[model samples]
Target: MSAPLRVLGIESSCDETGIALVECAPAGEPQGVPRLLAHALHSQIEMHQAYGGVVPELASRDHIRRVVPLLRETLAASGLGLEAIDVVAYTRGPGLAGALLVGAGMGCALGLALDRPVLGVHHLEGHLLSPFLSADPPEFPFVALLVSGGHTQLMRVDGVGRYELLGETIDDAAGEAFDKTAKMLGLGYPGGPALSRLAEQGDPAAHALPRPLMKTDNLDFSFAGLKTAVWTRMQRLEAEHGQPIAADGMARPRADLAASTQAAIVDVLLNKSLSALRRTGLKRLVVAGGVGANRRLREQLDEACRRRGVRVHYPELHLCTDNGAMIALAGAMRLQSGQAVAERHYAFDVRPRWDLSAL
Candidate 1:
């Protein structure tokens, strides 16, 4: 039997620096899902929180400090040396340019030092295929809903590297809507989780928010207006109270608005996802990316799919956010499926705005 291929993956495409190792059978060997050996992630959320958002330059410097240590920690956890890795992979696009360069440079340097070929994996592709790492992995030809801070897309997945774009956001993505709306509500940085947590306390039906593009026949999404609507509502609340609504205090009005905002987003996503499943006639649906971690979204999708007799899959919550394991697994799958090959040339470039459909 041929020796198993070990891949070391690096991800520094944004505020997090992640490193992981995955093992899989080489091409023409008995095909099986790649197994994650060990992984470590360092989120720059706390560092970026005070600034209200990520500062690209700061993020780049932080990645430089964190990547090497995280790599060593990952290697130690896996009990593997630099020579054990057969390939190196890193997230190559659709993120902060500076952040992308940090990972890409590190990946190439490692590849050169180890004399192993390197592969650049698309960021969205990593999120799209992340569900395969779940305990209940879905088969090929499934419908995929990829939702994150910067992207909101639905695709038809036939297999690795065989993706068909179904629909996407025309303006702000679901995660962006969450963050923007949270900001309007006076929530702190990294607003999505905060908004979701506050929404749990208030009535989802307390306020009526528009569900953009929900009634339209096309699956394209629009959330820019939703942010404006939240802002307008907050202004009205302040006018009524004769003071600004405080988010830290968890005021009833703010919580109600948060609930209403979350309901609107979740409703649109659920309806559109179900519509995509109907349009494709696919019985299996896979949800990946950060917003896939939303509890309300998950509950609605679960009930909706159950009624429709469709199967739904999601990555483990910890893996839903950006991580190196997904990048390594994507590279391993691409190689095993003959979809891509690692390159020996060390010269590297990054696409800060590459389209996943273009791949």
Candidate 2:
């Protein structure tokens, strides 16, 4: 077998601390499918859930505690060592400052120790490139819908490091809407997943949630209105019931609410994505970020794209959520594209708000 260029990736943008080892060779060469040698993730969801949201200091502390051990485990699982690693990649910006520092510090330290090349990967770029990790990687010059808790944006992705922001949310992101609406419904913290699960049985028709900016010519979105609509509907429901909707009632009405909310979100996302595609004149669409994990969102995008003869690509379910694999894969692609290089100074700082357009 030909020697494969192995890469170690570290991701710690928020509550997730991940480490992965991936190998690369010529795309169609006979070495093997670009393979995942090993991967590990440490989620701070449970810890942060208690606080209803991620506390940056807490997230940073967790990363320091988990990164080293996870790295050890990833290497061992992949049956490789520091010597086998060809490059080190880490997420550099657009995340909690503290958390990004932890990952960046760890990654740079590793690279320096191994005397290997290292690259600073944009968090969104990692998400955009995530689909390439799959066996059926999409060609470049595609449209991208990036939906996460902290961001909602559409982009024209021509290649690695070549991205143009088509549009973005002017207000609350779709994930934020889900979280806020879920809280209004007493869904507790980290409401996006919980709400999605509940939405499975909701009769979307039961509530006529507003599709914000549905008719706007701009690709920009605003979920604040939709979230307000949800709040208003819940208040009306409570007034009608004369008591707070019981947790038990949540089960009976959960599916309908979930379906409706999910539908509204799906509609907005779908409409905006298609609009971006039309404007870019690109038929292929890629959905990334945490919200991309939503089943309904994926199904709707796939179905709609199919009808229009456009294509839609998504990262694997595991990669859809925050993980180190994407960071690693993005780094590998950048290196292969000669777009980035290792740093001589190990004093890289985290950007809590890095713009993709800046790349």
Candidate 3:
């Protein structure tokens, strides 16, 4: 076997700054799953909580503060010095521009310093390929459900850098739905998980909420209507109680609403994923991204795919969120597939709106 190519990856796409090391076989050999040597992530959740959402400026500044330390942490964990890296990679686009620049600039500067090539990775592509880092890595040509904070998409993944968009959200993505619904419930910043925790206590069928576009023939999703329905129901409950319905102290009402909202979102995601699989005639389904970590969604998907005799795969729960490991792995895989080559020209720019299909 040829010696492994080591990659240092950096991610600062949103509220998280992540650093990781990955290694893969060079070209002209079997391209197995890239090995994740070590990774570290720093979340800006506590910092962003006061605002109820991420402040781009704050997130950008925090990324600047966190990236170098995280990189050092990852290198130490990997027992490798900076000189050991063969290439440097970073998330390049489809995120806050300032935040994207931090990683991009760091990666390019590192490449120049190390005299190694540099790669710019697509953020969603990293998410889409993350399941490969799992103990049970998926094979090629699977149906991928790329559901995240800003994107809800089903893509046909033929191989590395080969993605075909099947369907996508016309309005708010599933993560947005969860977060917005959670905010409506008075759950503070980082609402998705808090709302999910509350969802466990209540009955899902209690509110009879609408699942928008659930019956549609196409795989396209529309979640804004579901958000509106939740708001209307909460308004009705408030009027009936003669007070504003709040997230705390009203377990039954809030929990039931949280459960129903979660159910609705999970249902839509589950059905669309199944439809994508059915239409494509693929037997494997790989779910990745932040919402892929939703317990309810995972349970339903497991049950449904099990009955259909279809295989299902997910990134190890912790890797479901944004991280540098996936970016590093993606760079290695692209090099293996001869789909991409690292460049030495270090002049760097960030794309705040690049599309995966464009790759």
For model 2 the TM-score comes to: 0.94
**Candidate 3 residues 1-359, lDDT tens each?**
77899988899999999999999888888767789999999999999999999999999999999999999999999999999999999999889999999999999999999899999999999999999999999998999999989799999999998899999999999999999999998988899999999999999998988888889898888999999999999998877766666835466888899999999999999999999999999999999999999999999999999999999999999999999998998888888899999999899999999888989
Per-candidate TM-scores read 0.99, 0.94, 0.98
Residue 96, model 3: lDDT of 98
Q: List where candidate 1 sits over 4 angstroms from the true fold.
A: 247-250
Tens digit of per-residue lDDT, candidate 2, span 178-295: 8887887777878899989888867778888999997899999899999888777777777766667446755656566667887898899999998888888898998888899998
* Model 1 lDDT tens row, 1-359: 99999998899999999999999999999999999999999999999999998999999999999999999999999999998999999989989999999999999999999889999999999999999889998899999999988799989999998999989999999999999888777788899999999999989998788999999999888999888888888888888887787845449999999999999999999999999999999999999999999999999999999999999999999999999999999999999999999988789999999899888
Candidate 2 shows a clash count of 6
Error of 1 at 288 (Å): 0.5
Off by over 4 Å in 2: 1-3, 25-34
